[model samples]
Target: KGKAFFVDLTLCTACRGCQVACKQWKDLPAEETRNVGSHQNPQDLSAKTIRLVRFNEVKEDGKLKWLFFPEQCRHCIEPPCKYIGNMYADGAVKQDPVTGAVIMTDKTKGITRLESWEMCPYNVPRRDEESGIWNKCDMCINRISKGMLPACVKSCPTGTMNFGDRDEMLALANARLAEVQKTNPDAYLADPEHVRVIYLCESAPENYHDRLVASAAQRKNLVAAAPKPKTVTRR
Candidate 1:
């Protein structure tokens, strides 16, 4: 019923094409940045920079391997941010019924910025200092409405980004995982069944990125709270 993106992390070259394309299509300005030794730039996602290709270099078997993760919103099956936002301003953050896109709307201008972040387990959303609204990957709803792929998916030169119906994407994700496991037995699919943006990582999911998916610790906290959406007031 919903759409998804199956990202093969092994194939990602960290070219950052998806990053540039997202900025271009969203008309978001660049943040001031300096060389950080690694090819990854800007360090992290911001209000203007929604899609980021995160690079993590780790030593394995005495060899350094770079893991590139083109990170974006997972568009969770049960988005906690949407529930938290609805408490303060209904429709501020909603999951699109048709496409399953977890989008932050203009009504987000009314929500407490810190609460929005606290509610999001993945820590994906960013607040705009000027507009007071939140921003993150929207799955290019504007383009999808016209029957097109998301900007980042379209711009990816490698076959790392694949998008389609949820079932189709799942099938592809599993198939890719099987193939990758032959060479790297530790390969896995990160939260494939729980989110629309599925990542096929070549090693332990954590070796890819800290927030590659909602952490187990965060899940434990959510469970301890009885999954209640706590209201967050401005500090």
Candidate 2:
């Protein structure tokens, strides 16, 4: 079965249990961050930080509404970055045949930094400043391979994060969408078909992030805009 992640944003209270769990499981170091005048810390994804909880304020009926998006790699079915990198090097990026997890390997070091990192639509990959090696979520492949859920999903106390078979996840997302639409007509799933990480958003996806939802037309345009192999050198 294909791997899947279900993120119920409405059920999330922004407690950040998943965020800390990611850091802990990855054994990543802490980043020195100043008050950015927002509840969000560090402000963005980095090589050492694979996951982050994004906080946004929106005005709904003249009242302030806070929206939280626990952001990470979507692990697309046909990952553009993996495709672009493989055009240049054999093993720069890998897709797990079992779980459909996208992994950036040490072999990525051989690929030109600009081409490999810039190819991602979600801007998920980060290159280490000193080593110039790229890094992103691997869907906790090591753990999943052992029959365990990803750390973030395991750590979420509010049941905001879930992992399972692809079909099951999609069904769950739709059910949650129906429930949310009772009060939130704008509730929808962001990029449900194209991505493994399904997000149940309560408002316009743009209010959370520009890349949160890639409409069918937008995706088609992106595929069209991608440079052909003959026109561009991979490395």
Could you say which candidate leads in lDDT?
2
TM-score of 1: 0.92
RMSD of each: 2.4, 2.4
Clashing pairs for predicted structure model 2, backbone only = none
Q: In candidate 2, what residue range of length 10 has the lowest lDDT sum?
A: 110-119
lDDT of each: 0.83, 0.84
After superposing candidate 1, which stretches have Cα over 4 Å from the reference? 113-117, 215-234
**Clash totals, every prediction:** 0, 0
**RMSD of model 1 against the true structure:** 2.4
Q: For model 2, what is the alpha-carbon lDDT of residue 164?
A: 92
Query: After superposition on all CA atoms, how large is the RMSD of candidate 2?
Result: 2.4
The candidate 1 region of ten consecutive residues with least summed lDDT is 226-235
TM-score of each: 0.92, 0.91
Error of 1 at 226 (Å): 9.8
